[model samples]
Target: MSDLPILIAGGGIGGLATAIGLAQKGVASLVLEKASRLGEIGAGIQLGPNAFHAFDTLGVGDAARAMAVYIDSLRLMDALSGEEITRIPLDEGFRTRFGNPYAVVHRGDLHGVFLKACEAHPLVSLRTASEVLDYDQDGETVTATLASGERLRGRGLIGADGLWSNIRKRVVGDGAPRVSGHTTYRSVIPVEDMPEDLRWNAATLWAGPKCHIVHYPLSGWKLFNLVVTYHNDAPEPVAGMPVTHDEVRQGFEHVSPVARQVIERGQDWKLWVLCDRDPVMDWTDGRVALLGDAAHPMLQYFAQGACMAMEDAVCLSAELAGAGDDLEPALRRYAARRRLRTARVQLQSREIGQHIYHPAGAHAALRNAIMQAKSPEDWYDAVDWLYGSTGLEGAVSREARTLGPE
Candidate 1:
């Protein structure tokens, strides 16, 4: 079989970035998205140093920077008293230290930047409303079948379809992800409508036992993106699409009035059940491999979900560069290099959730005291291994990895 293009499932950030990265290396890839149009929910995300590296490497850094706001400071506050406990300034020095600025952007805006980059490349093609059913490999050629019965051949497959990935089920035999007994409610409110005090060029996090709240400005300060996560004992999942403001308020009533005020102002709130998988050693099955949430689903506590996915795209393309003559070695290398790192991130994020959200009496008191006494920079230092990663460049030594498989 002649060299075929890579088939990528899912059209979110990871899938699109993978397409752009592959195209930049003169490799061909096709993106299959189940949705008729690519759009994200009304929410915001924090993009740290590692994600910036992936954006720059993929050639979308300029566009993303233009649309995103650089968060110059992050403040942690007591949810009950509404009083600041720590303030971390993120200046040029911080950027120099981290190698990239910590920025925040609307989820849709970030996805749009990646989509534009993919659209410009000749080697990248996108097919919307096309759902992939399964894939089978024959030596060098991998064939993927869509639900519509259309078949497409490719050299490899990257399942970037996210947490409910159909491809992941086929590869790992469908085990349910662990739910942490928590649910998140998210919404975007008009900045002008919010209290003027809430408008800041920083991410503000209010941490409490069994609940926490994160708020930051978006759309160039035109809107405030708010997210509230709380523990729940209910056995059933929260229902209804586009959760109403009433639902958001009810979920956070146990929180401070400041938290209540933020939720009350949200008119277009949405809810999601937070779930994640324990990292697996096996993310590859022959020519088909997993990427992003499909490969290593993580809790939102660390805010590295999208960032890790973007890093995966960059590393996968780099590993497969110029391997058109042979496919097995390159695909295996990608899987091996990514599995450990992603698994660690998944585990760390889960641990952070338990520590940050479910702290016991002493643990909670100690956490509060540390936040007040320690420099916020110290907190960032603790996560340097995560935020400072340069993907494959940091994961594997370039000079050594060039020799191919060990």
Candidate 2:
């Protein structure tokens, strides 16, 4: 094994998972995070079976499962009538078919699981308050300059730095991400605080014209995570901005009474101006590569942003593990393997936001009808390509026999 480390920028889920994946392969990594401590600021995340497969590969499946709520089904309802349009059952048969169960978890809890695993690994070195300001890479190695005026050398570099990544500027040269003309308000409250009638233990989505609301139980059903999104143009893109409960209610005034009832239950709502970049052909330059949002930022409509990033970590480590002394080829292979899949997700997410989640008048009716016609098995088949397995050797896929989505 190489004595040098694979330096990673950003200590979020993607960066830490990359370090853990590398460590499992007897490779070392150094993760630099800008925050004083490692944590996630979001409320909840819905992880499909694919994420659990990645967790199993990273050796943290049990820990992650212990903190998550395994949902019974995913229900999509009409926000106006609050009627169930369709549901994808995640029951025993569904779990058997997918090889893993669907789960919803608090983002912070999931982050902690990855963080602890990385910290316990001897090959992984985590540094907080150490941001990557810039980098210079040659044929053999890459040097990362930190915000503290310190420089670190590594065999290669992975820019897991997220959407507004500094490394993305130097590598892809893409400017700021484009705003989606959508604003999302999110909050978490005690499950007991919600109306007794509204307390359901499944992942449910209420879809209306130009807006939608998604909520599910998290933290072992002790809390409920609610997110409401609508088409509202902000002056500029921002995240985690505080907004009043009234502001959130006003956005959904036209929604059904049931929807309003749920939206009004939360006190504090944080606003986020959603943004993403167009898919690009290159996510790698020489020995430095981009991962997660830095490579392909997508809207939350698909709920695969973090899932894809975790997949990238697994794939990157798998390719690099067998590349011998040549790191660039491995990085190129990783990018090639992920480019099409991530691009599909990026484009599909945008399309789903418009066609499926935000349709109007006749289009909305047609969407609901079409979804209603599909059987639960059909829904499972629709995502078979996504929730399958990666089947990589000497990595998470080492023990698997099939390759699934990215």
lDDT per residue as tens, model 1, 317-380? 8987887747677767887777777777687777777665456477877777876876657866
For model 2, how does the per-residue alpha-carbon lDDT over 1-406 read when each residue is reduced to its tens digit? 2577999999999999999999998889999999998889989998988898899988898998899898888888899888888888889999899899898999999999999999899999999999999999778888999999999999999999999999999999979899998999999999888878777778888888888999899987889999999887765898999998878876688888987788888868999999999999788989899999999999998888888989998899888886756999898888877877777778889989998887878998999999999998888887877788552422323223223332
Off by over 4 Å in 1: 234-240, 358-360, 394-406
Which one is best on TM-score?
A: 2
Considering summed lDDT, which 10 consecutive residues are worst modelled in model 2?
A: 393-402
List TM-scores for all candidates, in order. Answer: 0.93, 0.95
TM-score of structure candidate 2:
0.95
Could you tell me which residue pairs clash in candidate 2?
389-404, 392-397
- Superposition TM-score, candidate 1 onto the true structure: 0.93
lDDT, candidates in the order shown: 0.80, 0.87
Whole-model lDDT, model 2? 0.87
